[model samples]
Target chain A: MTHTSSSGTVRKGGTAKRNGRGLTGLLLVSAPVALLGWLIIYPIFNAVARTLFTAGDEGLHFSLDTYQRFFTDGYALNNLWLTLWVTAVCAACLMAICLPLALYLRFAKSRVAAVVQGLALFPMFVPSVILAYALIRTIGPNGGVDLVLNAVGLPKINSPYLTPWGPVIGLVWDNIPLTTLMLVAGLGGVSDNAVEAARDAGARRFALLRYIILPQIGNAMLVVLSFTVLGIFSAFTLPYVLGPASPEMMGPFMQRTFSQLSDSRMAVTQAVITFAICACFGAFYVRSIAKNREARR
Target chain B: MTAHLSRRGLLRAAAASSITLAMPRIAFAADGFVNVYTGSDSNISDFWTNVILPGFHETHADAKVRVVDAGDGAGLRAIADRAMAALGTDNDPQVDLLEAFVPDETEGSIEAGLWVNFTEAGLAGLDMVNPAARQTDFDLPYRGSQVLLAYDATRVSAEEAPKTWDELTAWIHANPGQFIYNRPDKGGSGGNFVRRAIHEANGRDPRKFTLDNYSEAYAAETLPGAWDILKGLAPSLYEGGAYSSGNTQSIQLLSQGVVTMTPVWSDQVLQALSMGVLPETTGLVQLQDLALCGGFSRITVPTNARNLDVAMQLVTYVLSKEVQSKIITELGGFPGVSWDHVDPALRAKYADVIPATIPTFPAGDWDAAINDGWYRNVAPGIARS
Candidate 1:
């Protein structure tokens, strides 16, 4: 988020004097880079180091005991599997929901499109804790929905809160605005003239979408998927508050292991494993961005 | 001065990086003063500085006490270790008095005689304190809080409310979707409720479990039955076994009349009622068979305390009827002394919050095992997809 906003400012100031621009850019980049290395990279190395070595009867020796325990422990593996499943479902749901909204906001010339776009983006401003609390009150048992249903003579609604469905619903809802924005940006390349030409060539709506729109928006959708998967995989508050107790997402599972179980080593192991999985999506994102930059050049 | 400046500069850099550096509550710990280190939260620190210390000052005007906040008992343990190290050596531990200190926090503290024996000393007001509140001779308990069943009296009748763990389980089954407890790992209310379940499962005995009794094999044998008991009772809970996230949320559910019963702290419920956040009919009760767990704040002075005479004096003063009432009305905690020994008016006001007995569970290895097992076997009957 900081990167996007800072890059926007740099672009606005592009007409600055060309001489000493290298030094100027270096000065501008150094603070954030140094901060990231100190705050993020150092902690990552420390966590990984703690997991790779174990203090034993002999001495502080290199060992994989915690990683071994995590792999052999059915409970730990189940948590990992649940995290992956939630991330996958959230990614799928985000795309399925956001693509439609983005398309409507792009093509629909109605005045209501502005309202729809604003509604889609509103969740971005609401903090996740507030959003989760609102979701629980609105959908959980004997909550607002049940109150209304009872007043009108209907059965109580079966709540998704505390089920595996809970975090999925929350993550999907929370990620929609960003996903829509990204897909809409990608959709900018799908010109109306191109769609018109495709239609004039006797193409149906589905074919126009598949041939003209999807090809242009494919990279944006990938970016959205990669970011959503990474974010949802490591989310703590929503899963800790809303997800089921058993078979937890990795974020809550690692925290509970460290805090409740008082096993810091095991918690670090779980984190390293989670980081290894997220690295795949992260690598894909970086590579795609690099490839995009290369294509533009 | 240059070295001091560099140290302060480094500390500032670290403070700028981290969001919250727990600033010491009272900072002037000068030489020749009796240093008091307390391991309680800011509220109890305020209690010491405002209520207890001011009263002590009237008796000993010349003496000075400097208080330090040792967050969550770690500071007290660090002092105990320092005291242990200083025994028979020509070094000063520099720790004079401790509040909210647990003697068992450090290994060998008991055998090493690291603390002054409270019972053996026979302080002036020790006779007034409840015998049940005393855990060991090494520590003096001055304040306490218990988890009780917070219920809406309008929905659940006086006779209908549960008095025993078994009765509570039956009531939950009979009136499905009317009871709630927060997840065991989230709050003490639910954690103690789960501990009560474990006690019930293991032949209704609290003595079988001890601070040092936890083992993987023992937990595997004992906790499976507890998981079965909790899992069997889960379907009858509010919204088919959905637990509250914390003690406050559990009471929130009760306040909304969605749940008739939940475990809550005595102090919190009373405060909430006084604040008009909950209905007037909100009542608190304790389970009879084996009571829910509660935490007691105990003070332990080291055997080698420099101001041992003054420390003993302060203990007796804090235990007196006057301060004990302040414990109730001001601090919102139970008096370390019995109800009959405290101020009668304040006693009458807190009669509803008082329990016949408040048993506590240890929070170390056993706590971890029970909570982790609960998450694994009790909370989820649904298969992992």
Candidate 2:
């Protein structure tokens, strides 16, 4: 009876200790979870709810008219198309340019590589508005580029900086650093030994890259592409300052609809649409992270 | 038992200290201070900081004025949205006074009944204010501005400059990439130009468009001519027909000698001249046939304002001749009151650029509709090639 009582007492103590630990854990996580719910999740829920309902002559009723208007309005639809087109082009261009450069920086030990990497990263320090004005000064009429062309006895190249190409170039310049950094980190996961073995087994440079490097960094590429799309999709400053006024990017279009047009419902609908589109890429990002964690496990 | 009593005592002391700390802030809020929310445009905010507030402080030594710089358009909308959100709630609005361009800029809040009626408030300068400047009895006109064509006198002589809309078009065609105007939705000057163009193109009476209601059928019927006119001029605009984004950009292009002329606000031109953003050689003119749209800046007190009487007194002082003349002389803002009430010297100073007839802006909805239409019908027609 004494031995049995002693074991029973120890078991009770263990249960009480576990209860205390569980309470502490709950207290620690509850604050951040509550904060996230209040700040981010609550606002999103409110926006979506507001878009789905409307107050009319009778009372609050379910409606899809706002979303219908967003999809049907020619101007809004054109802007949506323009936003997608610009974002897709920018993402593809960024990957094409940054991937090779990132790979080179990953393997090359030369000082020139270091200098190139530093140069690629330099634009991250420059603010978008300042960078826009700088671009205007360089490519505007009779600007530095024109002066250079004039001195070299060549016809001045007409500036494409004020068109859709303007924002694309600016987006590419702004995103190179982050994309390269992510990609270079990703390339680190590719085993040097595997690359060497492939090369020794009669694999050429193209084949080695196709079989070894690209496959290893697929998750990283998805991550980089997803972020680039999100960044370009919601970008405001460069597009506003440099791009055509009509058929504007989603950011400026939403702003004008809300502030200039004073159509809050339409603005919210547009915002929800933008969020849904970005969420597609966001899903990929989340999946990549989950997969990465799974791979590590 | 002793430790328990001490802990309870400590808790009581902490609670008392917290209440004491919050009491002063509540008292300060009740101390009868006017909170003014104005646009962050340097022309508006700087004039208040450097002139109006200082002058008001001299007369009312005991009163305090706090100015908040809510940015233009988007910023003002944010403020209005916040104030509207607090409606029917227990919380009072944080703002007392709102400063904005009349009609179009303040329409959202006005429609929502966020502003108190100034006519019943017994404002001082109501009689002296220009009838054209009075949007309604509820709107108190504080300052005025008119859109005008600003040009580089060194590049184009006064005799060479276009004097009518038709002449201006011909001049643009002749000069190719030497003239520019911003997108209508971006700035009041550009919007004014677009409105004027629509009025001229349709051959409709400008007064008909000034009513508050917008008819979609009427706009659909009349907008094609305006679009056609805009399309024809696009190929001759600066940078191979791509218009600049905003008024400031057009001004920048002019300052850089990239363009010979562009539409700009008369008051902004004066401000830019003083700041050396525009050369002294820059000349201003109102087209003889087309009266450019002009309007007054409005000041309204919200219903939830803390110091309602003091806010009224502050606006009264702003409308007085001493302040009006100072605004005209320093900031180039036209008098909110009639010329008879303005100082004669100030009246003569801006005589050259002031229009004899000011064209009224279209209804708020029409203004937005026209801007949107420009983006839709007109912008796409511009030959990018």
Candidate 3:
């Protein structure tokens, strides 16, 4: 009977230890989970809720008026179209620029590659506002570019920095550091042995890039694409300072609705629309991450 | 309990007494300080800190002033949103005073009952305020600015500058890519220019449009002409009619000699002159027979202000002749008071630029409608051309 009591006590002690660990684990995670809900998730849910319902003469009521207004307005529709085009173009440009740069930095055994890599990442340190003003000074009419052109007896160029191209160029410049970094990390995951084997088997540069490197960095490209799309879609300062006033980007349009027009409901609705569009890319990002994790498992 | 206190209990009592003693100092610190949320630039803040605060402290020895830079119009809107959110809640509105540009910017907040009625509140300096400066019973105007054409004198002589709306259009046609104005939606100066053109296009009296009520019928009638006029000039604007995005951008274009002339705020031109953004030869001119939109910056005590009395005191101090003169001399802002009340020297200094007769902004809704119309009809039409 004493031996039975001792064994039972041991089991009880074990259960208590497990319970304690479970409680500790819950406590550890609960704070961060609650914080995340409070900061990010709650605000998003609130914005969506606010967009769905609006206050009226009677009280809170279900309304699609804000969304209706956003869609019906031709200028707002143009803004959305412009935003999507700019974001897509910027994403394509970023990939074209950063992908090759990343691969070169990874494979090349030279100081020039290192210096080029460092210079490519330099924009990360410059603030968007500073970069915008610097761009203005560098490429604005009769600016540095004009001065150089004039010195060489060429006609001064009208600033493309003030047009749609301005925001595209600015967004690409600002995003290169992040995209290059991600691609570099992704290129690291591509095995050098595989490349050597491909080369030995008479694979040309283009063929090696197409079959080996591209497939290896697919996940990284998706990540870069998702973030670049999202960033450019919601970009404010760069576009506001660089782009035109009318047919504005979504970021400035939503800002104008909220602040200048004092139409919070409409602004929230615009935000919801932007989120819905971005969610398509975000879903792809989630699936890619999950696939990456599953493949690792 | 005190009579029968143990050593621990006595020590606790002593510590509580010390804290109790320090409470008044903390309360005094809180009460003596007035928090002002202003959309004014660093120049205004510097003046407030160096001149206004010192002047106020001399009179009221215990008073302390804290100026919060709430940024430009967009920043002020964020503050307004916060203030609106905290309304009727248990939350203490940490803001006391709000500084805003007249008409459109401040109108929404006033309509929402955020600002206290100055007449009801019986604020000081009400009698001293100029009739022209008073936007409404509630809005207490502090400093004034008018929209005018700022030109690079080196590029265009004073005689060569356009004196009327028709002449301005003619000049633009004569000198394509030599003049620019920002999009009307972005800045008050640009908006004023657009409003003036709208008024001119319809051949209506400026005073009729400046009324307190906005008529949709009037706007609908006037806007077509306005769009036509804007489109007509589009071919001659900077870069074959691509406008700069904002007032400052237009100024930058003018200063860089990219464009010879642009509409800019009177005070901004002066400020830019001092900053060397514009050359010494830069000149400002008001259109002949066409009144530019002139309005004042207003100071209001918020309804839920923590320091209402102190805010009122500051407002009164700001409106004083000495302070107004300092505003003119130091900050290059026109006084809230009438010209006669201003110091002769300061008035003479700005006489050439400051128009004697300036048109007030139309009702808030009308101003907003004009901006929307410009963006929708004029901007797009310009783009197409």
Candidate 4:
């Protein structure tokens, strides 16, 4: 009976220690929660409220007029759609390029690897506007490309640098380095032991990669993918400097609507739309992580 | 322990209360700096602050002029839209004096109610501006330029230079591939040249077209004429007919000897000449007479200007003879106020690169030149031929 009582006492002591640790964790996390609430949640709430409810002659009214205007306005819808497609293309292209580089960096060990990695990141170091300007001069008609092309007997192609593709190319150029860096870090977390085990089980190289390597790093891979999506989605400066007047991407469209048309309400509405999409993508990303974790378990 | 707890609570409350009280003052003081939006280059902005604002400050000592460079002409309009939105509230505006394209004054500002009408501002010496400037009520014509042909004298001789439009067209055809100009819709200089061709085709007067009387059908006819010329000239142009987007690109084309000549603003040529981007032997020339040319940029006070008197004074000073001369000589702009004897130093400095000056076709004729079978009917036809 005395031994049983001692065991009960030990259990009680363990419960008390856990409760103390929980309290400390709560205090630590509260600071971040407060910061996020102030910077992100509060401003978003204010921007939405300012857009939806304008003080008018008839008193305050909640309305969907701004959203309606954004959709029905021919240019607005066109630009919004264009922004969506272009961003998707950019994100996809960046992922395509980065994933391979990341995988190679994870597996390979060569002096050239570091050099290639450094060069990939160089575009990100240059300011987006400056990069756009440099690209225009290098590839543009009056720029060096034309000078070289002329010598090669090619007709001077007017700067292909003006197309929507121009901005996309720039986006990919910049994002490749960063995305690759993040992805390389993520891929490194993948277990070599898993791949070796699968190969020992008589799996082929591709099958081992598909089954073992991908699963081990699925969580980290999701994180990289979400970041790639978000980075391409909200990119503004490169597109703003290099893009044509009528690109249908979200960043330039929102900027043009706000700065070109004096449409604050509409701009806010567009920003809301972007935030909503990002939030949705974020939710999906979280679901992906959870799904992968559950599958692994 | 009880005393310590109470003292700590008191100190926290005191700090919070002080911060709350100080917040509004900080916010208020942040709005004290006035924002001026200008579409001019960084060099121009520096000139304004360095040369012009100091003169104003000597008189009003307390006022400070803060100039924000907003790209070039198109960018100015975009910035105006942004600043207006930011300053939509009645409390304070984000911008005061606007240095923007003259077209936006008529096309956008009046409709948006963003501009301050200077009629009742009691601005002294307002009437002293030239008559051509006074015609456009919203436009305070600060400077102007003509779109003309820029050619490399080293590549093509004066004897080979086409003097008239017909001769130029024939020469371009015979040469089979030598002309270069940017897309007319994109570049002002190219658009000017296209319009000039339209005027020549229709034989229309230049000074009469206005909002009062505009004929879209006439423009439709005249514009296609220019397009046709472009189609024909396409083969002869630098590429199979692709074009650059702006003056800078066109100038680059000329510099590279890609095309013997391309349409350019006189100021652009002068700027390029000053920058040593263009060879010393390069020169610019206007079409003989009655070409489409009424280029000007304007500055106006926003409706929400806090210091109207000071802003008005700043505008007056910018348009003053001393300032205009400085801008013309040093900044590579043409003087808008009057064409007086230039400084000898300036004359010597710019002797090799003096732009040929030409009078705009009279305003009435200008209308006829643009609207009545000028740009639409004539330009496209010339391009095809």
Fnat of every candidate, listed in order: 0.44, 0.51, 0.37, 0.05
- Considering just the first chain, candidate 1 attains a TM-score of 0.90
Indicate the residue-level lDDT of B307 in model 2: 72
**Higher-ranked by lDDT: 2 or 4:** 2
Q: Where does candidate 3 stray beyond 4 Å?
A: A1-26, A54-63, B1-33, B40-51, B54-62, B74-90, B101-124, B348-354, B382-385
Candidate 1 Cα misplacement greater than 4 A, ranges: A1-20, A57-60, A108-111, A191-205, B1-142, B215-222, B298-332, B337-341, B348-356, B382-385
lDDT of 1 by residue, B139-204 (tens): 788899888898899988888889988798899999998988998877677888888888888887
Q: Give lDDT tens digits, candidate 4, residues B249-275.
A: 678767766677888876667778888
lDDT of 3 by residue, B196-286 (tens): 8877876646766755556888778767887888878877887666767777788888877788888998877888899899999998888
- Writing each residue's lDDT as its tens digit, candidate 2 over B252-277 gives 88887889999998778889999999
| Candidate 2 regions with alpha-carbon error over 4 angstroms | A1-27, A53-63, A66-68, A108-118, A191-208, B1-33, B60-64, B81-90, B101-119, B202-204, B382-385
TM-score winner between 2 and 4, please give it.
2
The model with the greater lDDT, 3 or 4, is 3
lDDT tens readout by residue for model 1, A67-186: 888899888888888898999989988888999899999999999999999999999999999988888788765789999999999998877877788888999999999999999988
lDDT of 2: 0.82
Ranking of models by DockQ: 2, 3, 1, 4
Report the alpha-carbon TM-score of model 2 versus the true structure. Answer: 0.85
Candidate 3 overall Cα lDDT vs. reference? 0.81
